[model samples]
Target chain A: MLITRVKKKDAILSLCKGKTLLIACFGCKEVHFEEKEYQALKEDLKTSNLNISGEIQLDYLCNDDYTNKRFELHKKEIDEAETIIIFSCGVGVQTFAGLIPGKTVLSGCDTYVLPGFSGFTPSSHDCEQCGECMLGFTVGICPVTACSKGLLNGQCGGAKKGKCEVSKNKDCGWERIYNRMTVLKKDDLTLKKMIRVRNYNK
Target chain B: MHFTELTKMGKFVITSELGPPKGFHIEKALHEAELVWPHVHAINVTDNQSSVMRLSGLAMCKVLKDKNIEPVFQVTCRDRNRLALQSDILSAALFGIDNLLLLTGDHTTLGDHKDAKPVFDLDSVSLAYMVKHLEEGKDLAGNALDGEPPKFCKGAVVSPCAEPLEPQLFKMEKKIKAGIQFFQTQAVYEADKFEKFMKRVKEFGVPVYVGIVVLKSVGMARFMNENVAGINVPDNIIEELKKDKEKTKSGQTGIEISARLIKELKPLCQGVHLMPLGWDDKVPEILKLSGIIAEKG
Candidate 1:
């Protein structure tokens, strides 16, 4: 489950000058939302003289059909609102914006990563789906997700003592790749082969 | 006039870095450049080195060129997009500056301007590729140049002392494939490790210059050990610096240490890139002490 933090009250208040519709997605199963903080936000908004046209809290806001159905049910309230504030992951905000065109859809929350298991399953590795997979050559360590900079060419000169400079707790992805390649006795061959430059268009 | 020609003739090339000042007063900076002129073959004008805002490297290169000193134009992907980078490349060419050092600059967060947006539109490898395309009279979009396309002697950076060194080697090979003519490595403090690194780098057939950064004091050494990436200043060097109880003379000790490293590293690589880190006046001393050049009369 993606970890999210609510945007500052003042910043959220600024985007919601007119009558605003609020859609807060608690996310799918196993996701955690700070109910106290969210409730405090609604109370603060009310105290700040914000016109709350409608409030809808639901799960799976990224699901287009589910979100569209929810919108239909709240059509009257949605129609009256001048701004739509979605408190969810980036994907959910984008999905809402995509469904309702020409509307000021603003994100009320920011998404952050929690190291492992970014997808549905509880796995050690996560793929960013960068289109071109270097996992085969890298012996399964995904550099795009693992490296803080998402450097594709190789390791930047930022890793120190097997740990990443950006995040001290994290292992240097290229160091892991190097160690794995050595274990498999593929380092020599890997060194000879030119690493393909990342196709940014992909 | 390419310094690469010296490498072709098997001369042990010597280069140094010149950080553009934060403000417009460039008299001291120019004097610093002249101080090392008798010692170094070329000077690399840093492009916001360490992510700190400074005078434009291209502008400084032009200034250095006016003094007849060969300048290596250092460009980073941290500040500009493809359009601005291409424009600047052509502009550098227009000024008759041909030597280029392409780098994926340190992140913007590391600099004085922490809130600045970093634009890594083209990395060093891709920038080298773009330069190759530009040399062929084409821009990145295949647009033809109005005049003679710029030809540059392009160089790139590598971290030879990186832990699990194969990834750096992999990238180095890719850079060479991307038409990078030479390489200047990240600060190296260990001789044995660099010797091993050079053994692999030699197969690539590109001139690899060992970078020697002067460690100013015990604090600086410890700071780099804890903070800087890929630079591991061994405890022995720190102990050596600490032995110089006169903190004022630490600069002298730092010069001694750098000269010693350059002396040890001279045989292992094609050249030495001295990064004195504001100790510009000490470069001639370091060069003379390392036996790179004779003592001036």
Candidate 2:
């Protein structure tokens, strides 16, 4: 599940106008929706003089068929609204926008990152699904997600004392890889075999 | 002179860096280069060092080339995409600049333009690979060049003081495989630590130049320790800079510290790359004190 935070009130208010429809996606079981904060934002929109045509809560806005079926149930409310505000991750916003053409669709939240697996089962690492996985060589620590720059070759010069320069609190991914290699006695092989350039086309 | 030829001849090379002026006027930058040109084999022109916007290093390299000075054109993967980077490489070749220093520059957030988009379309290793392919008369797409292809004595940067030195070594090896002829490391303060790094680096069989960044003051040294990555300014140097605080002779002290570092590191590496960080005028004095050059009569 992707972590996200609500965008600033003024930013959401700017896109909102007459007969605005609010759609909230709260399907991710692991993610908690701040119902109180959502209510507070609704109150804020009302104070800002925006006409609320209707409010709809749906599961998995990113799933096109589900969103399409839900939108059909609220066809009159969807058509009456001048603008649609979706409180979901970027993917869901884009999915909703693609389904409804010629309507002003704006995102009410911005997605941030979490350090866990992207798949359904929780794990310590994430796989960006770059098609070509180097987990076997890198000792299972994914540098693509662990390193801020997603550098595939190795560590950039910014790592210091086992910490990343980009985020001081985060452990340097390469340092982890190095420690793992040493423990497994694979440092020699790592030094000998050169990692090829990542096929970005993948 | 080609840097590759100098290294091949086993010459103890000395190189310094020049940061181009932010404005169009290149007079001051040229003057600074003139100060250390006599003392060093080649001068590296930084590409918006630290991600701060400045005059293009390529333009400064052309200016230096016109002055009959050898320039090591520094290219970073921060600003340009693959197409623009390839074009610039050819442009540098057209201007008769042969030496190239490839770097994965500091992120955009660290620069003056915080909101600017970073384009790491091709990283330092990939860039070196691109250069190798270009030298073979083709682009990365396997297209043939119409005429003579460009040749370069490619160099890359390494961080010797990295906490986990193995990864840096791993990347250095990759760079070597990518046709990088030599390496210039990030600022190294602890000679003992650098010595250890050099011991492993020797197995790679590529020339490694130890980097020496002058520490201007205790505050500056402390700031770098707290902020800059892959750099650890030792307490002894900080204390030395602190001793000069009363007399405001930190600048002199900085030169002395750098010269001392060069002396200690000289035996451990193939050459030294001095990064004066705006104290270009003091490079000559540092070189003389370090015994890299003879004192003027």
Candidate 3:
């Protein structure tokens, strides 16, 4: 699932200062999309100078076929409005803009994405998609994404107290790899082998 | 001694860089190579260094080889795909070039030819691994090589004074794992920090040739500080350069400073990789002043 957050309310207000139509994606496929946060922004827009001509709660706005059908169903309401604000990620906003030419399609949300797992549910884990995957060798903990230094072999000397030397807040990925490997009875998963460079194009 | 030979002999190896001319100024490139060849163990040929197009580094290495000067062929990942990179390894070997330095080159947009597409099919680490594979007589796809494997003294670049130093350290480990035998650091001015960095790097057990870029003027130092990513020039060095108004005096002072840095960093590092920044002829003076070589009678 893709992650997203609302654009600044003040900027959205100015973009929709005139009569406008609000297309909100209620069915955002994030592990946890702040539905109430969007509701709060809608409340604030109600108090602003922008007159809401119509509102459509969209599901899977990034789906071009579904979006096309929805737009056709609400053609009268959309054409009547001066500006259209799509409350979703960049993909949804781009889809609306590309599908409806000459329409004022403004993005109400900014895309905050990580490399998403295909299966549903939000995860803090992100795979940089560096083509080559070394998860099996490192006991499933990704050093490429988790480690501050992105080291493939042993950890740099900077790791202290199982925390990253660069990013103090983050856990050292190598430490986790070590601990996990110990648990799995694989004491030497990372031993005696030189890990090659990660290729991101994969 | 050659670079690897000197380092292995524990003789505090010294290497210097030589930028091939941007145009087909073959004579000028040869002249520059001849100028710095004697003072250092080996001359590193730049691969269109700083993202500016120039004569290819492999060609320059062949040039230096013909002159009986050992060359470290610097290869960048910015211009070539994996196939080209592997092929270049064979070509460098066939040309009798043994030293190889791999780098993730500067973006093409940083160069004059912005429109040219950058083929980053392999980064520095990957390229280093590919070279290792070539040495092992196998291609990246695990295919058998046609003949004898290429032999090389592999090296890579590092920036020890990087603001967040861990990333650089991390990549250094990766380079080592990829079979890199040596390293050349970016311009380093923080002597204390570099000492600490080298102390940590010693555990990796590879020779690092500390990079000393001669800063000839306050403007040049400031330009590097602002424009270059990992190079950090201390204010005192900048103020020292600013003290001298005469170009000759400042240039001489720059050489002294570079020599001093080399002398100070000698204990912590295995060698010095001098980057003279167009002042290629001053290399001998720097070596003499740094006590790496003796003054003439």
Q: Which of candidates 1 and 3 reaches a greater TM-score?
A: 1
Model 1 lDDT vs. the true structure?
0.79
List of chain B TM-scores, one per candidate: 0.97, 0.97, 0.96
**Number of the top-ranking candidate, with TM-score as the measure:** 2
Model 3 error, position A66 (Å): 18
Best first by TM-score, ranked: 2, 1, 3
For candidate 1, lDDT tens digit of each residue in A98-202? Answer: 566545566676555455666362234444544444443444455676776666666777778888876778888777766665654542354344545555554
Instruction: Give candidate 3 regions above 4 Å deviation.
Output: A1-202, B247-250, B294-297
> What DockQ does candidate 3 have relative to the true complex?
0.08
Model 2 residue pairs with clashes = none
DockQ of 1: 0.29
Q: lDDT (0-100) at residue A73 of candidate 3?
A: 94
| Model 3 agreement with the true structure over A17-132: per-residue lDDT tens digits | 35689888876545235578888888888887669887898876767777888989998998898678877655555556556654555766644445656423223455443434
Q: Which candidate is the best by DockQ?
A: 2
| Candidate 2: CAPRI quality band | acceptable
Cα lDDT of model 3 by residue, B184-287, tens digit: 98888989999989888989989998999987788788877766766778899888887766853548888888889988998888888888877888899888
Off by over 4 Å in 1: A1-141, A183-202, B247-250, B294-297
Tens digit of lDDT per residue, candidate 2, span A1-202? 4565666677677545578999898867644456667778888888878888889998677677777888899888888887788876555665676566545566676554455745242323344545344443555455666776677777778877778876778888877766666664542364335545566664
